[model samples]
Target: MQETNDADTTPTHVETAADLDARIDAADRLLVEFYTDGCGACAAMEPILGVVARETGVPVVTVNPRDDPALIDEYRIESVPTLLLFEDGDPVRRLADGFVGAERVIDFLA
Candidate 1:
């Protein structure tokens, strides 16, 4: 298995659907943002997610569902900037509103 530095606060980019599954399995609690390129709200959330990761010690990841068509269908992601909270490898919460602030993100994780 590849060694991962759990202390890293940078949001991970999930390139493929399988990689997304692997990441979720690896982390005890994970926040995944499904975003598309050229999306303003998605771009806006980048720094906010970074801060959330740093403040809460929760691993945050971003995935472009367009890169994996199956992911779009599997997650039923209808919009960019959809946030999914996964705990113990199962999805427990979803926040699909656009351009959510760091406070709301932190509260969702909490």
Candidate 2:
């Protein structure tokens, strides 16, 4: 089940807290990101993650922490570009603070 959005090749927008839980229930893999608009780290992370998402066939949702108030509080994300990889609703990998690089992301996925 592949979906498309302007954001990514297979993008799933998680705008609300309930959307998050619902998505987790239905998807096998979820790449959830907490990003801020003006953050350098978040900007760098997006394209790297875009490639990773396309290559791995993963569903990705990039959320703006500033806008998603509930999500910001729920995840306790202190920094921009916090990535959480979930397998069957369970967290498999978490890259907090910011995105490192494609290689690191690929290594984490592997």
Predicted structure with the largest TM-score when compared to the true one: 1
The clash tally of candidate 1 reads: 0
Model 1 spans with C-alpha error above 4 angstroms: 1-7
**How well is each residue in 1-110 modelled by candidate 1, as lDDT tens digits?**
22335554789898899999999999899999999999999999999999888888888989999999899999889988999999999999999989989999999988
The root-mean-square deviation over C-alpha atoms between each candidate and the true structure, in angstroms, is: 4.0, 3.5
Q: How accurate is candidate 2 locally (lDDT)?
A: 0.75
Model 1: lowest-lDDT 10 consecutive positions: 1-10
Q: Give TM-scores for every candidate, taking all chains together and pairing residue i with residue i.
A: 0.92, 0.78
Quote model 1's TM-score: 0.92
Best by lDDT: 1
Query: What is candidate 2's lDDT per residue for 10-76, written digit by digit as tens?
Result: 5555667777878777778778888878888887887788777776667787778667587777777
Q: What is the lDDT of residue 90 in candidate 1?
A: 93
Please report, as a residue range, the 10-residue window in candidate 2 with the lowest summed lDDT: 1-10
